[model samples]
Target chain A: MIWLPLVGLAIGFQIYWLPGLSLPSSVAAYLSLATLAGLDSIFGGIRAGIEGKFHDDIFFSGFVVNTLLAAALAYLGDQIGVDLFLAAVVALGGRIFLNLSLIRRYLLTETRLRWRREG
Target chain B: MSTIASPPSRGKGWVFQVTALCIVLGMLLALSLRTQRRAVSEGIPNRWPALRAEFINLKQQNASLQKDLAEYKERYEELLRKQATGQAATLGLESVLQEAKMLAGQIAVHGPGIIVTLHDSPKRDVNETRPEVIENYIVHDYDIRAVVNELFAAGAEAISVNGQRLIATSSIRCVGPVILVNSVQVAAPYVIKAIGKPDVLQKALELPGGAADGLFLLDMIEVKQQPDITVPAYSGSMRFYWAKPLPQPKEKSR
Candidate 1:
């Protein structure tokens, strides 16, 4: 869903407000918020794909990639003295570049529903 | 999520992803806020208690300084006023007191000398501005005691407070709320007569704000010396409890 980036932004803001919060507690709070956002996104993504709507592989790829990248950057920032915001930006930027090229339109149109509609 | 001839790879359910994300983010927010608060409530210095005590001592010293400074200002202003009015111009009395202290110290000291008297000032009228000044007025015996100590510190050969001859085993003790030197109780207006380098002893007495903070409790307290002073035989025992050194921290073998 379009909410992927929104969710990412929301999570960023949450952690930004409380930098020194230990990992376990952040995991707990984000888990609940992410659960609600994730469920809504999954349903929206599935519906759009079935309707031959805009393939959300790009969005899903971006979100997943960005999430992992963000976590890694945060860890790196902890290890080094890099600014957290800059680290987050590097993560988000890296994910956007990897997703657009890797997530293919051919892969999307070859789906089962698309085959049913054409063949 | 895209149309796929086969199907998408087995993706973790939204529930799992959501659960992971929510749990992680919450804990971090709380901790950052806590650490920020800790820094501000305590300043940069960790050894604050001693620093604060020193600060208090300094503030007390400052207050005494301010009192002296104010007196100096008033006297200076009075002199200024006199100079402006064309009255006989001269240096301030504080300087004169300082000079007297220096002169007294210079002229009175070592071996033997005279004993001068320092009595309480004339009692103030009830209508006086500050009542505490009069109510607490007294040549607190420590005034003499402090002078005695200063004389000792200044290498006085012999000393006495208020005409009482000091002996080898003598003590200046506060007994029954009345201070006693050589077992004789002396009241306000005590005189400190010493025999030593008079100049050094007097300079020692007037070395700045007179010893009232930890010594005498009165207004306009001072140390005056006799014209002729001499040192007598002096021997005394001094004792103090000494503390041993503390052990340092060490690491354990793992």
Candidate 2:
């Protein structure tokens, strides 16, 4: 779950560096986002593989979340006067929060359990 | 299978799991990066707003360069098309401009073109208009075309829609009444620039059957040509577009 937030931050890093100014560039930006999203999926796939279950299934969830975020961003941009940049921040920011929650609920909870087992 | 497994081996298994996860994460990060780079090079700057704006600028510059490129391509094609047309090894930008200077006509003039600001009627909403259809508030493609055509006919050699110069392959398309010049959206008051026999071009526009006739239909219109003349360089990228092309007839394979 925290993967989502991490993705957002990474996108933020991209915006801070390479900003686009034209229609085609908007497409380029999307391509970049998709690339990063793909990477995240790959990582997820590898993680799943090690888990001995359907390894690549994690990417499916990532795809759903990213697509929703992309669609929401388009709609929200039109609703408010927010440009793509600001809207991305919002999406990424939301992702970060969700990721943090995932880390807490899953990873951190697991750690706590492991400590109890050891104790 | 684990009945004979040592405690140290179990611990090592945990370490291996963590390491695998780390490697997977690293691979994912690398893949994400590859995607972003490829996207930029391929002309799909679809990331966020900040980069989006920069890409737009690059695209605009690219269009100018593209226009010049098209001019070269046209001249080259013309040479190839004409058996009678003599061949020139480099019919490039520099030589073309140089030739133009050498053949510069005595009547040619330099000046700034008119910028017409046609505001949407106070009651009409531009945002409300369907970009897919024509509407009254926005400027129509035909109007701009008429303006450009009249300018050229009047002897204007160089022209630009908004700040974007019109090269040979430049296209002006209408989405509703909104006209896109060089695939960049522009709104009124439209600033059209031209370099030509200034007096003749102006007189042609002001002629009885010119852009004037269409003004009454417009909520606002203005036209003029002044002498503080300059043509800015195209600053956008001219990337190759493979798709979005019209279907060409394919030959049947034997």
Candidate 3:
């Protein structure tokens, strides 16, 4: 899961060659928000997996719903003259940070225990 | 913590799904950032009917917000009038805010000033068969920027080009054949309106070797001083993501 973004980065290089695949500038906001939502779902799934609660169905549905909801919120904001995407951004951003912190703590504690037992 | 139960190994298929989704998400994020950068450097193309709809919606929302703001201000003023000390303090703060808004180009300004209109010379192609010298006959982004810089130097309080108000972050650049002011494409003839002293602005422009004279010599730019004009406030996001105020130092406890 940690290496997932790096893999995405490697694949992102193809975007330069496939210029026609690029989205219109107008939808950039929605797309970016959707990506944020997707990233949040991914991290949540990873956390769930680590906590012995990973479920395939939950991960799949959560990913799709989160993305769509985020995009929809941005579209609604554009229509209503408010930046609803900011809410999604802040929420998803906070979750990502929280999840990362937990993941870091878990990994650190696991490594320390394993090291003590081995020694 | 180390002895905690881990989830059952998800099959390769689940791994594949998550990996694929992650890749897609990464690509989308990268593409969005790239598009944002392009839009910043070379103004986004004014395409899509949806954008026009969004513009209409935004205009209506702006009107409603303005109404709400006025109502809120009136309520606040009424409350302030009830407290003499708070009223004075608030009055001072209000004036400071107004001045700050003016300086930030966030407030609409109206005053006597000059209007400089720059257009490509009509007789350029008619007389000169040489295509290389045609560049001198047309207005460029730098020309507009120079004119703006000169106007500011003359103490112009506010300025707008093609109704796009100039702010601190306003960028003027040439994209292809069109000139972009504040990332909005502006077509010729570019009518630049500046709010300041009418005579001083006019004089500053017409000064020898100034923006007006240099442009006129090259492209026959027109500078006009009008007695009354209005420059609208900036209508864009003022968010500064990278900058933050430093935390105040706390007094050391004895």
Candidate 2 residue lDDT tens string, A79-116:
46567545554555555555445435656677799999
Q: Fraction of true contacts reproduced, model 1? A: 0.03
**What TM-score is obtained by chain A of candidate 3?**
0.85
Instruction: Report the Cα lDDT for residue A102, model 2.
Output: 49
Supply candidate 3's per-residue lDDT for B190: 94
Against the hidden reference, what TM-scores do the models get? 0.28, 0.31, 0.43
Which of candidates 1 and 3 is the stronger one according to DockQ? 3
Q: Model 3: what is its DockQ? A: 0.12
Worst 10 residues of 3 chain A by lDDT: A13-22
The fraction of correct interface contacts reproduced by each prediction comes to: 0.03, 0.09, 0.26
Best-to-worst ranking by TM-score: 3, 2, 1
What tier of docking accuracy does candidate 3 attain? incorrect
- List chain A TM-scores, every candidate, in order: 0.33, 0.39, 0.85
lDDT of 2 by residue, B1-120 (tens): 222222222212333333333343444344445555656676654445555577788989999999999999999888777734333334555576875643332123345554334444
Candidate 3's displacement at residue B60, Å, is 66
Clash pairs detected, candidate 3: none
**Which whole-number lDDT from 0 to 100 does residue B208 have in model 3?**
94
Local accuracy by lDDT, each model: 0.50, 0.55, 0.79
Best first by lDDT, ranked? 3, 2, 1
